[model samples]
Target: SIKLVLKMLDRQMAVIDKNIDGMLKEHFAEKLALFKDFKGVGPCMQAALMGALPELGQLTHAQIGKLVGVAPLNADSGRHKGKRITWGGRATVRTTLYMAALSAIRYNPVIKTFYERLLANGKLKKVALVACMHKMLTIMNAIVKSGIPWNPEHQNVSKNA
Candidate 1:
């Protein structure tokens, strides 16, 4: 239901976006006006990011991953040959983040290039996409951490993940 509401809100916003030339005098007009030009990010992704991490403005990358349930958990045991990885966090958050990741690939140049490079390196299609998602979350963490909006030209240096 949350996603549904977001989708509807996005649609309404899109309609308004298409006719923004004459709606510049309303209250909070300046802030609302920015929505007319806010490309790349959409309502659903924005809502998800805000809802999934209300304190995103204060959290670190590790905390963000843990919040979204993407940080792999320990699965080692006495007889296990390898660790058993699993998804044990909020399913909805993970799904919404993944969708946001896909949209970033379409709209964000840095992410799109990284995704293409990964594909060119012979990574499996799904694997490359997930890597793109991970990188996006890391980028988001750094952006929020610095209290700055995303800048495509600024190269993100950390590859620790």
Candidate 2:
């Protein structure tokens, strides 16, 4: 009976997921396509982004990062300099971005290389991951703003230049 109940719940969840996907495609097709263009960004991340950050394309990268609570803020006061830390803003968006970043670091070429470079440069693993999350967010923001799909070649050229 317990197993049957679990199976029923799983089927319900699958149906709900399918419905959400259909609704997102129907209502936010363009935005969903933009989000899905990025490597490792899937339907769930696209839905979360579209729902939580309706202003994604309208704001600057720094502004979006700050809004999502991923931007590092200065904690300095006169000569008493302090480490920059991220705080405040929408926790759900931040968490979603973090998950997206984790996947990106594994499968997205630019993200993976950038993450490795940061680690090689002696940055803490968590710090590097956060930086990757911020970078991914910025990339997505720019993509949405410019109406361009994710292009690793373009990103590489810009980085070199």
Candidate 3:
């Protein structure tokens, strides 16, 4: 009985995925096309960006980073400068970006070199990955905002990234 239930659930999930795929291809075809040349951004990333972060291209780089919770907020007071920590945002988008950054560090040329440079400079592995996520998000924002396909020139969203 349990096996039958699990099988039915799997079938329903597959159908739902198919429906989503068709919807995106139909209504969001242009938007999805924007990601065609971008590395590390697959169907899942596209869907996450469209569904979870609808404010993608409309916002600035810093706004997008904060929306994804990748922006580190400094906990500072009058004279005491506290640590910069990241917390609180849309978790689904952040987590999806996390996985995409992992792939980007391996495949994306710009991201790969940046990740390696950070490691060479003695930044922690986690910190480097987070930074890559920021870069990836900013690049995507620039692409969507400009309505241009991916290019290395879009990488320069800011000095830090």
Using lDDT as the measure, the top candidate is 3
lDDT of 1 by residue, 16-95 (tens): 76554233344223333333322335555555565555555467776777667777567767877664343666676678
- lDDT string for model 3 (27-122, tens) is 778877888977899988988998899898999999999989999899999999998888888999999999999999999889999999999999
Give the TM-scores of the predictions, in the order they appear: 0.63, 0.91, 0.90
**Distance (Å) between predicted and true CA of 115, model 1?**
1.5
| Per-residue lDDT of candidate 2, residues 1-161 (tens digit) | 99999999999999999999888889889866766557878877788888888998899999999999999999999999999999898888888888988999999998999999999999999999999989988888998899887777895688899
Locate the minimum summed-lDDT window of 10 residues in model 1.
Answer: 30-39
The number of clashing residue pairs in model 2 is 0
Candidate closest to the true structure, highest TM-score: 2
TM-score, cand. 1: 0.63
Q: lDDT ranking from best to worst? A: 3, 2, 1
Candidates 2 and 3, the one with greater lDDT:
3
For candidate 3, the lDDT comes to: 0.90
lDDT of 3 at 39: 83
Worst 10 residues of 2 by lDDT: 31-40
Residue 112 lDDT, candidate 3, scale 0-100: 94
